[model samples]
Target: MSPVFSASAEIDDGHLHVLITGEVDMATADTMFQAVLREPAERVTLDLRAVTFFDSAAIHAVVRLAQQFPGALTVLPSRQVHRVLDISGLGDQAWLRPA
Candidate 1:
């Protein structure tokens, strides 16, 4: 079955806090992308604490956002997501973290 992904955003300390839930894949990446794009904040923190699975497309979405926003993207990913990011060579980026 295809995994589901959902995101919610809030403003905190002058930053955008995005909490992501479920799985992240091609099916759900666009929702996440749009959510972040719509939020008006200088800093964006993505909380992947509830994300159960992440694929290359999801990783690409994040990388692309990072590239677009530069130092404005911060990721708080679960251990599995963190491993995927590390394996995908996205760990070296200044925005992703293992949570």
Candidate 2:
């Protein structure tokens, strides 16, 4: 079995930066969802550079996160991670920017 996903967040210069690791799937997507949205922030940056795996559920969670902050949510997705976003139509959303 895979290790449970883990995430941490910090506010830097008015932007919330969340670092995530492990697999983010149906079982763990909500954790990232709650961790990020529970706090009110003008902007959010999800650091998915360390995430080794992610599924459609994870993509949905990120879409929701994007809705919460609209144009203020930036995503730092690994090269492998970008494909999912592109397919999900999230990559086309003006609200989501890849870094």
| Top candidate by TM-score | 1
- Candidate 2 lDDT over 1-99, as tens digits, reads 865589998886778888888888998899999888766778888888777787999998987887778789888887656767787666766755563
- lDDT agreement of model 1 with the native: 0.85
**Candidate 2 to truth, TM:** 0.84
- Determine which window of 10 residues in candidate 1 has minimal summed lDDT: 90-99
Local error of candidate 2 at residue 19 (angstroms): 0.5
The lDDT for every candidate, in the order shown, is 0.85, 0.81
Each candidate structure's TM-score, on Cα atoms with residue i matched to residue i, is 0.89, 0.84
Candidate 2 wrong stretches, greater than 4 Å: 1-4, 95-99
Off by over 4 Å in 1: 1-4
The CA lDDT at 42 in model 2 is 83
